[model samples]
Target: MSAQLLERGALRYTPAGVPALDATLQHAASVVEDGRPRQISFEIKALGIGAITQALGALALGQEAEFSGFLGQTRNGRGLLFHITHLVAHPMPANAL
Candidate 1:
């Protein structure tokens, strides 16, 4: 999904000492719902592990990018977190250049 980086927590390490990062991502898009045009927006908690953590950390807050990952429960098992496995930054629009 394409999302904006909303918040980024300090980088930390897992129990085994693997790098980890937690962030909040916001996604907004328009879609057809029941043949009707609809707009949707929401925020989700995300995690970046290992090498992905470094890349995710490099992104500035509010930056937009495409992210690919799987969903899983947070460590506390009380919330969901997106485990980012791949990330691709969107190119800047020509007008912005």
Candidate 2:
């Protein structure tokens, strides 16, 4: 799904030395839910690991893109988090919505 890149924390590493980054995403869109169209908005915690982590670290603030990933609980907390496996740079105007 497409979302705005909200923030990226400093790069971190796993014990295996895999690069990783934590961040947040803000998504707002009109979607069909239960039949009718509805506007939805929410925030989600996100993660980028390996080479993707460095890629995410270079993104400019407010950049938007579509990402492919899975969801899971935070490493040491409670909340849904998106584990980004791949991303495509879209660069849409931040205020276009």
Candidate 3:
């Protein structure tokens, strides 16, 4: 007799408010023995003080600005991992800061 199987999708969460820079700077890890489990980490880095200042200035002027990017990772089993980091930023309201 053949048995039927069911699969479930992954779950995710996004916290409200800005994340800490230090927390975002740390490396992350994951482990799995069954199925093809995947773990993803995300972070944002400001290119320079000028860029960040400009973004903040835009917010003060009642304009909105946004920056975004991605993070990549690969695993090969002998305790080694590879990753490509990325960052993004959005101007918050002057009062929000």
Best by TM-score: 1
Tens-place lDDT digits, model 2, residues 24-67: 98899998989999999988889999989877887776788888
What TM-score would you give candidate 3 relative to the actual structure?
Answer: 0.19
- Residue-wise lDDT of candidate 1 within 1-97, one digit each (tens)? 9999999999999999999999999999999999999999999999999999988998877878999999999889998999999898776556654
lDDT of 2 at 22: 93
Worst 10 residues of 1 by lDDT: 88-97
Q: Give one digit per residue, the lDDT tens place, for model 3 in 1-97.
A: 0111111112222264322121112223454647776664433222212233333222222232333333333233333221212223344556766
Q: Rate the local accuracy (lDDT) of all candidates.
A: 0.92, 0.87, 0.28
What are the RMSD figures for all models against the true structure? 2.0, 2.7, 17.2
From the highest TM-score down, the ranking of the candidates is 1, 2, 3
lDDT of 1 at 48: 93
Whose TM-score is higher: candidate 1's or candidate 2's?
Answer: 1
Task: Report the error of model 1 at residue 10, Å.
Answer: 0.7
Model 3 off-target regions past 4 Å? 1-37, 42-45, 56-97
Error of 3 at 83 (Å): 17
Q: Model 2 segments beyond 4 Å from truth?
A: 92-97
Q: Which stretches of candidate 1 lie over 4 Å from their true place?
A: 91-97
